[model samples]
Target: MGRTASVLLRVLGMLWTAPNTGLGLIAGSVGLPFGARVHFDPHTVALVFHRWPWGPGGAMTLGNTILHTGETLDAPCLTYAHRAGHCEEPPVRIGDHERAHVYQYMALGPLFLPLYLVCGGISVRNRFERAADRYAQTGRGWWPW
Candidate 1:
C-alpha cells in the first residue's frame, strides 16, 4: 500500500472503531484513580493501562484499549486461558495477542464484540481468541475468521 493509502486506512480504522474504543476507554479509566497507569503503545496503536486493579491477573483487549494487571505486557501469558502460563512450544508475547485484538477491532468496528461472543464468549473454542494466540505465537492471523 502507498503511504497515502496507509494513512487513510489508519484514519478510517480509528474512526470506524471509535465507539468500541470509547467503551474501552470508559471502562479502563475507572482504574486510573486506583493507581493504574495508562500509556499509548505505538506498536499496538492502542492505549494500555498497566497494573489495573481489576480482572483476574492478565490482560484484556477492548477495541484500542488494553487493560493489564501486570507491569509489562511483553511477559508471557495467555489473555484468557486458565493458568496456561508460559509453556507454549515457543514463548508468546501478551502484547502481540492483544495487538491482534486491537487490529480486529479496527477491522470489525462495533461488530467485534458481538461477533466475538457469537464465535464463543471466552474459551479455547473461540476462533477470535485462537487467532489472537496465533498472532502472538507467529505474528499473523489476527482476523476473527
Candidate 2:
C-alpha cells in the first residue's frame, strides 16, 4: 500500500464505477462533438492530479490544482495533492462552486478576483452551465462578471 499504489487504486475505483465508455449522450447538449470524450464523471469522486513536472509545491495541492483548472478553463487536468503516504483519500470536488468560479474566471479574468473569492460559496450550477453552453455555441469571448 504505497502512495503511488493507493493513488492508482483510487483512480481505478473511480473509473470502474463510471460508464464503460466515459462518453455520454449529453455531449451534444453541451455543444461538444457527438463523440467527444469526457475527462471526468460527475457520478464519482476521483483524484485528478495536475501534470506537475516540477513535483510538489507551486500550488500542487489538490484544491489549488482544481482551482487553477477552473480558473484557466483547462481540461484534462490532474493533481497529486491528495497523497497521504499509502492511504490517500479521494480528492474533494469544488463541484458547482468550482464550476461557477470557472465560468466567472474565464469571463472576467483577474479583474474579478474579489468575486472569485466568493464563488466557492455560491450554488449556481444551472447558471454556470447556461453560460458555458452560450460560450460553446457562439464562440464568443467570456466575461467574468
Predicted model with the maximum TM-score: 1
**Mind sharing the TM-score for model 2?**
0.22
Best by lDDT: 1
For each candidate, give its TM-score against the true structure. 0.90, 0.22
Clashing pairs in 1: none
lDDT of each: 0.85, 0.32
Candidate 2 lDDT over 1-145, as tens digits, reads 8999877865554344333112222221232332222234232232222222232322111211131223223332222222323334333233432443333433343334444345542223333333433343344422433
Off by over 4 Å in 1: 79-88
Displacement of the residue 6 alpha carbon in candidate 2, Å? 46
